[model samples]
Target: MNNRLRTTLALLSLAALAGCRGDREDAPPREFFPDLDTQLKWTPQGRSEMFEDGRTMRQPPAGAVPFGRRAGVSDAAWASPWASERDRFLRDDPAYFDGTSGRDAAGNPVFIEKLPASVSVDKALLLRGQERFNIYCSVCHGYLGDGKGTVGVQYSPVAADLNSPAFLVADAPQTKDGYIFNIIRHGKPKPDGSGGFTMPPYGHAMSEADSWAIVAYVRALQAARSAATPTTGGSR
Candidate 1:
């Protein structure tokens, strides 16, 4: 063959060989599907990191001490300074909060005490008032209208002496049933007292009928406090 024809044939042969190269990218990767020899021999354990003669090794021996051991876990305890406890949490609370049903046996809402001289109520209402007062008020305000309740002794600012006439004096319009109703609905907040703690507002806790009934009973309590105890100071 002439030199040019022979060169052309050689170039054509090279292109055919190039196309047959299964190792090229478009050919499915040999690494993707391993041959029998590679599959049997290649394994994760086949490769390993070697420690050269003078190189510092990273892995510690099985029983070797950890260098610069991590700091020990702390065992210190902590508690909040302002934690508050409930009355039930401590048995010392005398009242101990026996709850009221807020209703009489007849299903009518009732007060925590008795009716005043100005107003008369049925026996059912009076009985219900007595029960409510026994549940709520008698703990701080005495059952006898003396403000000397079993739980009152524990108070930081001593309980008011309800037996004294002056206690009612400041409650001007004290005679007014409406004023009593106001006090019951929106508890009297004491501004000057040792405790700004007022009686809890019954506005949300009790119905209007119940609030008025409580006012009526409280007036009775007030009247009881005003009751005279005749003192015949030895016939001097």
Candidate 2:
């Protein structure tokens, strides 16, 4: 072909390529994938004409439970931390999650006397418990569990002395591992049944494993106190 014809054809091709470049225009552009631009999904806090409530978000079904990570993920080496977290969310074990093994004849929850088998009672767990206790419990229970913390002194009904015999003796109801674990997570309810609590629950802020760790630490403190106290000799 002639050089002038070739130059004209090249110019036309360049112009066509420039037109394909996306740019602001007064007219609406054609969309090859309309779904990508306008998805068939409801936006958060948006109104929906299809539903009777006209709200985009719907309430979960009655008795519905939340699902967490799959059990298979627990087998992975890197997912060990998440494995424990998954168990916490699932809460299948009553003793570990609720701190109660069963109910007594009167229907009162029977708390377990020892920490669950899943929990590892070690120096690391105690250290973690100490750190968490200092941050949360020490404010009321005192660093030594003596109910003499700065905030405890000012509290209306002063915090309980955790080192007291009621909480130290092995057979004491309050000394049960599950009892302490439950108290740490669910707090103590007022006797009046006025929907009030003597102490506020910490389950929202703390994890189940951490609650168990605190129970272990509280036991350690009670044991230390018992050992230091000079026993009275009966005969000699």
Every model: Cα RMSD to truth: 23.1, 15.9
Q: Write one digit per residue (lDDT tens) for candidate 2, span 1-236.
A: 69999999999988986897777778777675587777678898999998999999999796433355454353656666766666767877888888889888999989999999889899999999889888999999999999888998787688888988787556777978998988889888988998787877898889888999989988888888778667798777
What lDDT does each candidate get? Answer: 0.53, 0.84
lDDT of 2 at 139: 91
TM-score of model number 2: 0.61
Which numbered prediction scores highest in lDDT against the true structure? 2
Worst 10 residues of 2 by lDDT: 63-72
Pairs of residues at least 3 apart in sequence or in different chains that clash in candidate 2: none
Q: What's the lDDT for residue 114 in model 2?
A: 94
Candidate 1: list runs displaced more than 4 Å.
1-120, 167-171, 192-196, 229-236
lDDT of 1 by residue, 67-185 (tens): 23223322233211111122223322221121222556897433223233324576666666666666666787778656688886566565555556654564344444554565556
Q: Count the backbone clashes (under 3 Å) in each candidate.
A: 1, 0
Off by over 4 Å in 2: 1-86, 229-236
In candidate 1, which residue pairs get closer than 3 Å at backbone N, Cα or C atoms, i.e. clash?
A: 114-217
